[model samples]
Target: MDKQKAQIWIARVLVTAVFAINVQCAIQFIAWPESYTYAYQLSGASAEAVVRGYGICFLMWNATYPPVIAAPHRYRVLFIVVIAQQLIGLVGESLLLASLGQAAGLGTLAASITRFIIFDGAGAVLLVIAFALTMRAARSLKEPAE
Candidate 1:
């Protein structure tokens, strides 16, 4: 297969994995909101508000990913947007843990946070590579070998 095709397939596969994970999270939030709230150590009122809003937001944002995966070239801008969101998520999660983890005693949530960091971090890295390859592939078409 060609480099571009390989890159596209790689990105799609990685993105599908991320999508699947998000689906699970959304389902958990929807199907067991109270359980999720307790698992995340959130209070009743706040958990109710957060789970409802954030869960829907998560579903909505994730719903945009399939189009990008289906046609990366057509959705190049969205690819960048996805990359940015992943970075923000990773950094924001780490910052939250760093700033409040100690104070809040987040050790009990190590496994939970670790899974998020791993998946988000991996997804970000894959998308970055895919973007670079896509750019290179596009440029190669415009500038032939010297």
Candidate 2:
């Protein structure tokens, strides 16, 4: 396979992986909010409700991924948006984790937020790599052949 095709494939794979991870999380949160509340040491109906709400927001956020994953070259601009969103999630999660530092009884919540930070950070890196590869492939296609 040619370099451009390979790059596009890699980008698609990366984006798909990220999308799958996010969708899985959303499904779990929505379908079993109680699981998350238990993991985070949260209690009561309000905690489960909040978890479900977060799952809904996650679904809304991930709605942007499908078109781009379907056609990375055509939806190249969305890569930027995806990367920006990943960074935003990473930073926000980090801030929240920091704010919860060393608090007794909130350790589970902090750990859960920390996990999100790691996931978002990794996702951002993958997206950035994919975006670079996609851009390089696009550029190669546009350039005059030697």
Candidate 3:
């Protein structure tokens, strides 16, 4: 395969992996809020509702991925959007984790938030790499051939 095709494929795989992780999490949150709450050491109806709400947000956010996954070269802007979103998630979750601190009884919540921080951080890195690779490939196409 040519360099451009390889680059595009790498970007597609990375984006697909991110989408899969997010969709899996969304399904778990939406279909079984109780499981999430229990595992996260949360309790009560409010916790369940919050989990469901987050799941909805996940679904909405993931809407940006399909087009990019389908034709990343055509939908290049979505790459920027997805990368920015990942960064936002990472920063926001980091702040929440800091606020929770090592306070007593909040360990579970902090740990759960930490997991988000890790995932978002990793996702952001992956998306950035994918975006760079895709952009490089696009640029290569525009450059004069030797």
For 9-47, candidate 3 gives per-residue lDDT tens digits of 999999999999999999999999988996567789998
Question: What's model 3's TM-score?
Answer: 0.92
Regions of model 1 farther than 4 Å from truth = 43-49, 104-106, 109-111, 140-146
Each model's lDDT comes to 0.71, 0.87, 0.86
Candidate 1 lDDT, tens digit per residue, 60-142? 86876787677665577787887888898889777766665555556656555666788789878877877776566556544
Of candidate 3, the 10-residue stretch with the lowest lDDT total is 137-146
1-146 per-residue lDDT for model 2 (tens digits): 99998998999999999999999999999999998987677789998998999899999889989877876776777767888889999999898888887778887778788889989999999999988888898888774311
Stronger candidate by TM-score (1 vs 3): 3
User: Following a full C-alpha superposition, what root-mean-square deviation does model 1 have from the true structure?
Assistant: 4.1
Which one wins on TM-score? 2
- 117 Cα displacement, candidate 3 (Å): 0.6
